[model samples]
Target chain A: MKKITLLTLSFTLSLSLILLTTGCAPDAKSHTGGAESLDSGLPSENIDATSILGAESGIAQAARPDGINPETDVDYSILSTETVYFNYDSFSIRSSERAKLEKIAKWLTDNSGKRLMVSGHTDTRGTLEYNRGLGERRALAIREYLVGLGIAQDRIFTISYGEERPADTGDNENAHSLNRRAMPGVITK
Target chain B: MRSQYDLNSMTKKLYTVLFAASLGALLSSSLFAIEVEVSGTKKIAVQISAFQGADAALAQKIVTEDLRRTLMIDPVVSQGSYSVAASVSGGSLNGKLTDTARGSEVFSRTYSGELRKMAHEFSDDILESLTQVKGFSTSRVAFISGTQGAKELYTMDIDGANIKRLTSDKSISANPSWSADGSSIAYMSYRSGYPDVYVIKLAQGIRTRVAGFPGINSGPVFSPDGQQLALTLSKDGNPEIYTISTSGGSPTRLTRTRGTETSPSWSPDGKQIIFNSDERGSNQLFTIASAGGEPIRITTPGTYSAEPCWSPDGSKIAYSTRTGGGFCVWVYDIATRVAKQVSPGLAEDPSWTCNSRHLVYSNNGSLYLLDTVTKQSARLDNGLTNCTEPAISR
Candidate 1:
């Protein structure tokens, strides 16, 4: 058993903390290196030390949770988060989003006590921070409408991606357009 | 309903009482002969009404109040003196100079006619009282108005007058900035597949791309000297702030932070750059050395604040903030961290005129020039998709 150094302990700790924000894990091996790469503040020796302990103890593996991964009996295909989006920097609702948001309002009302999370996103045209704020703005936009429809505001929480987590990460305008969206997902009921 | 004549009578009585008391006070008074030391640049003057039956001191007071009201709308006249010294004799200001270019010189020029010189003095004094910054009443603003689906750039008076569309190419134009000389403007246009910054010369009628990065290149802010621009570029990877020469050159990286930064606005002195960032968590205004040093967060309570425009006098910074209710334009007085919501609701991207008296912004897809002192507003245009990000040129 290798003793965990302070730097590795903190690095792995924060990696789990960030994972708490966006629970995505494509592959276990890919994330360790990425988390190691993200651990620029920590030295390579410490990262290597942590990587060995991570493989043995499986602490790093559990931190990167994946709801969409090929695991368990839950069919993640048919079940997906509610998709929503915003127009440019505006938070107002357009006529197009009425049908989708209306269904969402009904679903939340019927499924009372369900803890829903709304995440926002924006195009790469603006600043990342701006996109994140826009993402939050988009989520809040839906959250407000849902509340207006009698959904309790406390039942919904928001996190902003600010153009970071893209549904389509292509370089073109079309991809950027699709990436700017807010998709509400349920964490608990 | 009250008659119009009754209102006039009340006004006349108020004026007469002010005149009698003011005249009596001036006549009975004596000057202490205290020569007040001028601090930086005291631009104070009394607006002596050249009107008959108008007492000099009283008229000065009245004009001062009116000027203050105009200031409420314009924020151009900071502080000034209005003289009641009504050329005290023949009662005729026929030959007397009511203002600088001759009290009567400006009637043809403006309603401020005969009041120009004194107003200029008031304006200059305002410049002094505020921060002794450059007086820029003659400045202008250029902004984008969404036409059809495309956004077109338009230039107008600081008070939203004489509006003329500067670009008609039917492209999505964003982030309009004025050169120091106020002759040229640089804005981001998506005429190409990806958005790029373009500069248009007012004198030469030349429109050319300023920056064509591989990815996003936007949020351009012309340097105080009009030599360089600080903008956001994502060509290398994630978004970052880069400065390029106005003449065109490789952009120098200002921030190495992995997170993004954009909406760079220069302080009047050009000593610092206030930009929108989220390194702290959410989008808020932050100030950094123009030379690029440690970033200081300026926003505290607000969750969202963007497009910060500095006053020409450098006393206040106007930015858009999302209160718990909705978005409103907030003015942060530098001397006192007292932030005030100047506009009632739905206003953003404030631009200060040359004089820095009035600010023009977008309110619900319409361009509006807001008088800071008078609290009066005039709509510049209607029938647009949506407009925001107004930039004033000196």
Candidate 2:
């Protein structure tokens, strides 16, 4: 217990040091100026520093318009096992992913407030136009299967990113297999 | 607080901006004519003599580079079968092409106006008269080039000179289809964060989203009359072929299928469209009337084929088909229903010139113009990498 507390204390100090160094830089100070400095006279004693630090870092990382780092922001661990993979030049869902689609359907039923989005992707094997159509078909297939499994159709949205977004950037068969997938995400908005 | 430090920084930024602006001005005005040479062994031999008058050497050099890059003609110093004797008088250029072997004049034409325009006109006229084939010399091809996330549209002359960037959306903008009259280009862009078909007028630089249905709106091909566009949209549950008025309205669905359909190309009469559909398992070429009807599968014996383009004369349909060697350009004779391989390497998206004798396609990242008569393929190196989807405009 003592070791954990000490580690947490050091981590908090380091985070504060980083925030001060980055947030109080000359250019940042010049832009933000006196109003913010005057308002932030003292750190609140009752607040949780970790959550404050997380919120501060999130604000700092708002460079992306979506405010979510495409690489790491979304916790797709829930849908990682439910990912539907497709064959090369084909968008039909393989027979193996049907069980996972059932699980996803049940999960959607449990979490009625959450909306789902299926984004289709493809490998870099064919023409852009063909790949786009293939990607959309893959997404539609997944949506239909989910609908068949009792998921509400109106709660799900589909978008085909084509070969624009790839899970694996390699050109080999293994990478291509990983790239031809339909990813699941929650629509917060 | 207007501190002296702030004032000094502002002045420094202003000076830097001015310096960059002046440098850009200088580059645009002086170095607009890109100096590049194309060399090949199997080239037609010709001699370009020195011209006399203002900007004469520049004009001669531009003409030589232009003709040399075609990969069809070679400029020599002496002992040439054909000779191009040119001279500048006042603001116009007087040029003549003569057959040295027969000692007869092939043609003579006078080009007035800018020196660059004169050089281009002379090259076009010389090529057309000598070879009896339409010259792509002065033509321009708009293509898509950039990294994956930053793909945009760009246009360049056939000689790989005078590159002009058409779209700066900094997003994915591709599949540029030029209108018959070259007044506008219809392309698919994701600037609104969704793939939508947008038409951009070249003269006024106005972009209007012609088709933005619920789902995919791509592969926008203009009709021969430029009154309508045939594209692929997925609003009806699956990717299907649809045709919409160029002015924008409700899109009439053409192909109602459970499989994928894309890459629509119009015939010369604009009565039918040849597109790729995977309804029978593998992507293959299919033809259907523009109004809508049953789609007839055109590819037989081959399971994989895509990117079909019908010739201007409506004689052949060119597409990329995977053979034992690899994916290559194959021209299918509509009359006999026989397919013959035209391009040797991995080539796709064949767009024909107005002449119908030559077709342009992208091999890997470089664009090449293939001469159907001689079976010769020449690389059009515009110094841009990842260039694909070429559309020729008159």
Considering every candidate listed, which one attains the maximal lDDT? 2
lDDT of each: 0.59, 0.77
Candidate 2 structure quality by residue, lDDT tens digits, B106-203: 98888998777788889878777766556666678999998777889998878777899988877888899999988889999887777889998999
| Model 1 chain B: ten consecutive residues of lowest lDDT | B32-41
Candidate 1 per-residue lDDT over residues A1-189, each given as its tens digit: 999999999999999998898866434332111111121122322112211211122211111112321112122122144576556554446668667777777776777756566656787555333654345546556666666677765666544445545677677868866777777676442
| Runs in model 1 lying further than 4 Å from the true structure | A1-179, A182-189, B1-137, B158-162, B373-376, B381-385
Q: Lowest summed-lDDT stretch of 10 residues in model 2 chain A? A: A31-40
Model 1, B269-341: lDDT tens digits are 9888887764444466777778876666674345567778888889878877766444677777776656667
Most accurate candidate by TM-score: 2
Off by over 4 Å in 2: A1-78, B1-43, B89-91, B323-326
State each model's TM-score restricted to chain B.
0.66, 0.85
